[model samples]
Target: VCVPPESVQPPPGSHLPHLSSRVMANLDDGTQIGLAMSRSIGDPEADRLGVIPDPTVEVMDVGALVQEAAEALKVESEDEVELLAVSASDGLFDHVTPETVALEMARSLYEKEGAPRPLLAAERLIMLSSRFWIEPQQVAYRDDISLAVTKVNKGGKVKA
Candidate 1:
């Protein structure tokens, strides 16, 4: 999500030096998601004003991508993989950026095909990353489920 400079405002009572800091975070599987802090969803105000979807194709399965790359590259560990988000603008932040975490793995796969759809890569990464947000039972079963969020969270304890 990208926020315009004009719309960005600090919380009700806080004094920050400037606007627009880049925050990048890496997930357990090594996918990087980068967020333009000033414009990121962290701040509801900024997010509501303006936000943009990533242009690159997202790769959801970061770990799977790494494994695939490792196998393709003949590398032993996920650490051996390196990725760069071509669309990520440069900046700094106190915490990891979601875009940085998300795009890293996407870039790796995109690069294999000579820089294809960056947004598409991002989407793919997101889909794969859903593996971690899944229910423990689903993970164990390795089966598709359409359980409602309420039921899933309560482990079927909630009464209808």
Candidate 2:
């Protein structure tokens, strides 16, 4: 998780430049990079700000979460909706939450035009999230978005 640059509990004994939150770190190459991520790789300046590449393992039941959110979408049977996992870059998460994506997928399943599928749901999610990242009214940025969605049958086979 990325904490505020100005937050208390800064890296132990690492004195950052003044106005720490605005500018993350200054590299030896005369380039300054601003970032708040707590864990990363290939960033020497970030190391000064206490960022580490060490990964934290968090185990969660994403399938249960999606199933709960898509409770309204179970038209045929209880097992009709079996979402196994979700992966996305910060670009997608900066604008939308997992709950929003799950709810949107559930909503997409109800469309009247054609067959409801997770692939279509994934496309809708990218399009919706892009509005927040690229619009001038919103927080505009050049960061790209990436994510995945798929269904899993009882036999553990994946369906796109």
Candidate 3:
């Protein structure tokens, strides 16, 4: 569920900056969800804004996730596999940024299982562009190496 940005309270000693009241007021009339900012993510703008990184790390069964994805993509048992991690967020102040979620997921997987590196090194990370005015109701998953390569080559820009 989404909440107004004003309703989100930063944790104690958090160095992250909150969204300005003016920006909050200018948002659509729908509930606002603030995205957690990370100053240490090496983004100059994020550091300048004093955004705090998300602290929550949710660990999932990577094998299970991969299996589900493989099944959905109709891959054969002997097919080579790569894992693409995608995070989706409704464009709102209260929602966590898709980058943060994707990063945390990769970090957690690396620390726990140590297999996603080869997958990630193969350029398998994907972050869906934040959607405005609509939440994702369903996703059509496909494994398109050419598309992924093109996105990476273009500096990760998703065409609308």
Candidate 4:
């Protein structure tokens, strides 16, 4: 029976000549290769036979990666960590410390007890605000005073 025109017609523009064999065998490895009918390389029946290039495999530069890792380790692990992070509520103040707060409290208490009459709110605030900061420890004491002042400012009565 005569084959259909669509089935018999070769691919467009590939110049590979039609050899006797349905599949061309490689002399080096006896593996068979088919014609490139799907590719747009002109007529396949007249195309010349040649060696196809093999896919390349790339090698990773492991020595460079190791050197970079060693440098990073050397830099990061050199010195001891300096400043330790602490919570804000850990008796630390912006400018006053716990010892200074204690000293101020002592001074205020001494002034209050020495006074013949009770101190007014303005007078108490004046005593607290007049304190000068000397060190971080002093500022830390003021942290407690800050809390106390916050409570008082919020309309909570200060306990004796």
Candidate 5:
């Protein structure tokens, strides 16, 4: 819910929206907003500028995923995961690639013992983002690390 589309691709020959980078949307007044995403839950100012509260949803068969990972990893032990779901704000997404997040989650879940540690996976992803992306900056800034990792089983049980 935090990353904007990065850049808006206006249709064929149309003009782009009048906005700045990152935040994307600009106000009618001489105001530069720091709002992150193009979609938000509740922000009247950003809403006026075309940010909607709509969300994108996807459904998939985690059984197939489980089998696929079992085959790929070649170890169908108890640590074999059913599903790994990562939800984060722009802080993580901007700093790290999806693959990096996936690897971190996979390692946290598979390499660790006992029940899937989605919380640890989430923490690792956040730390990874801050450590690699923000810590090396000349002027370090704090972005809200709103993230969660969820493990969903075949029986629709969720653990976080």
Candidate 6:
């Protein structure tokens, strides 16, 4: 359901397209649901030419993702896993290490958003990094991680 800016334009001489209303509603909803990636071109020439940047929206079923991850990791319950989503800004490169960036993000979430910090301290941490741009646009990468905690039983044994 990717509604590019170019695709949402009204026909020449018309007030609005028939599908514009529905598309706008979907895009707005996607943005609120964290399924949309909005990026603007930083090139001055492109901006002067009236280039409108469109957002890329992807809808994901989180339940299905958790189930798949649990199976892949051979975990008994999905409740043992936590998902962390973080976006890297232009200043991210100033950090010394990826771990530092991750820790800062986690701390911010805990302090600002009141997110539980213990979830971030899970035993297994899977980091995924994605680069969106090559240059000027900051060459930013969005990092997402799945953290899972394996429960331990009495007598110092790990429970499956």
TM for every model, in the order presented, reads 0.22, 0.49, 0.26, 0.18, 0.58, 0.30
Taken over the whole model, the C-alpha lDDT of each candidate is 0.45, 0.61, 0.41, 0.35, 0.64, 0.43
Instruction: Point out where model 3 deviates above 4 Å.
Output: 1-54, 85-160
TM-score: model 2 vs. ground truth? 0.49
Point to the candidate with the largest TM-score. Answer: 5
lDDT of 5 at 68: 79
Order of all candidates by lDDT, from best down to worst?
5, 2, 1, 6, 3, 4
Model 5: CA > 4 A from native: 1-36, 42-46, 75-81, 110-121, 132-137, 156-160
How does model 3 fare in lDDT?
A: 0.41
Worst 10 residues of 1 by lDDT: 145-154
> How would you encode candidate 4's per-residue C-alpha lDDT over 35-133 as one tens digit per residue?
432222344443333222332335545445445645765656312111111112222343345555434443443454553222343244434443532
**Model 2 Cα lDDT, one tens digit per residue, 1-160:** 2345567455667674222233355689988776545556567766665677555557766656556746777555555655545667767887789898766665555444654576777877787778876685455653567787543344454555
lDDT of 6 by residue, 1-160 (tens): 3355555567878965233211122354455222222334354443333433544446666667667868887888876544445433433333224565556455544454664454443311222222322232464444333332232222333445
- In candidate 1, position 129 carries an lDDT of 45
lDDT of 5 by residue, 1-160 (tens): 2234545445556665333224543568966556544566655665556676556668777777777778887885635545668777777887888888877776676564653476766776788778765566645755666777665666665456
**Backbone clashes per model, in order?**
45, 0, 6, 25, 0, 0
In the order shown, the candidates' Cα RMSDs to the true structure are: 20.0, 7.5, 15.5, 35.9, 7.0, 15.9
lDDT by residue for model 3 over 66-107, one digit each (tens)?
677578878885133344444332232234454554454445
Worst 10 residues of 6 by lDDT: 123-132
* Clashes by residue pair, model 3: 33-93, 33-94, 33-95, 34-93, 34-94, 37-52
| Alpha-carbon lDDT of model 5 | 0.64
- Model 6 residue 21 CA deviation in Å: 32
Best by lDDT: 5
Error of 4 at 38 (Å): 67
Candidate 6 deviant stretches above 4 angstroms: 1-50, 89-160
